[model samples]
Target: MIKTATRSTIFLFLLFGFLGFSQNKKNFSSIPNILQQIIPNDRIDSWVLVYNSYGKNQEIRTSGGKKDYTPQFSGFNLFPTEDSFYYIAYAAGGKMNYITDLEGLRKFVGKIDNAEEAAIVLTAEGYMVDEEFKDVAGNYYEDTANYYLDLGKLTSKECPYQKTHYALTVSKSSGDVSKVKDNGTYIELYNKKCANNPRLLKIQKKEEPKDDPKKSTRRK
Candidate 1:
């Protein structure tokens, strides 16, 4: 799939409420208060940080938080950058938080590689784990930000519906994705809220056309 949006501002966090991924922050005995805290046993290679920038001026970018998320993500603590405006730091060794400052982040990722770029694009587009990719593990990416995934504008999603490759636009959330596409695999904990979803049921139930009985007959 092609990654859309060269520049994205995730202001409206909406859609599927999946569980945000978490990681434990490694505490060091020599914890420096400054940006020198980029220590992963004092060694790291690849890492990723997904974040959205916000400010008072909708036009001007400023050093602020990533979307509405706090420094605390699951178990990992999100480290802010000097310039938390136009950057998504490369993944170090473990799943680190999104840092805006490029120079400050380099101390961790070492160098921004191609893999890091792709990862950034994917996370920005709100797909894979960046958005709400389940099954890779118990980690559910329940991003509340309004996102655009391919052609399908998913307003919301309750669980993971294993697809067989059919392109469909799910505008709203669902309790039972099976009602939408009966012939697909799915993994879910609960959908008690989606049992009476009239919209999902309407998508599959097509009205049958009645045949005209008053048409011309052979030789009656």
Candidate 2:
């Protein structure tokens, strides 16, 4: 009698385990339909995975902030004949990235000089880029043109320390480039906090003229 009871208990446990596994598949059944209706001219692959960041591992949240582990998928497609785009929904991680291709994604990651959490998504409207960089602990400094290139080549008329993080083709009704500069203003101003001897901004500019002393006097 004891042996029979033990066998029955084990059977029940295995039966419940199999049921649970089968239910997980049901949860994913909507993935194909969702992809077909939403993603145009694309093949999709869906996955559910735990994400790790900031030394913590947690489930993802949807745009509505509901915590759930549904299959998130990526689709690759060609649009407008020559243009290519891909889309991936990351229901967790609280972020989305878009890029032109996998190669572009890889290059973007390599270019990040400061360590920060990031993800790439592929899109048709050029690569939508977003990133975070470690800010100087405090203060701002004026940087040379070389310094600007080393960090990220950005043109600014009023500020020297601002950094560029995103680019988009701006068009007015007449199809002319808009003349407003936005982004990196605070990054430029905040740099003054950490700069040593703010006067060095002048010195750095001075070094360039030394290469041609005659040119230096011409400016004066």
Measured by TM-score, the strongest candidate is: 2
Best by lDDT: 2
Q: What does candidate 1's lDDT look like per residue over 105-126, in tens digits?
A: 4443332222222222222223
Q: Write the per-residue lDDT of candidate 2 for residues 171-193, one digit (tens) a residue.
A: 21222223323344334542444
Q: What lDDT score is found at residue 19 in candidate 1? A: 18
lDDT of 2: 0.32
RMSD of each: 20.5, 24.6
For model 2, the stretches where C-alpha displacement exceeds 4 angstroms are 1-42, 61-161, 165-167, 170-186, 189-220
lDDT accuracy of residue 111 in candidate 1 = 28
The local distance difference test score of each candidate is 0.28, 0.32
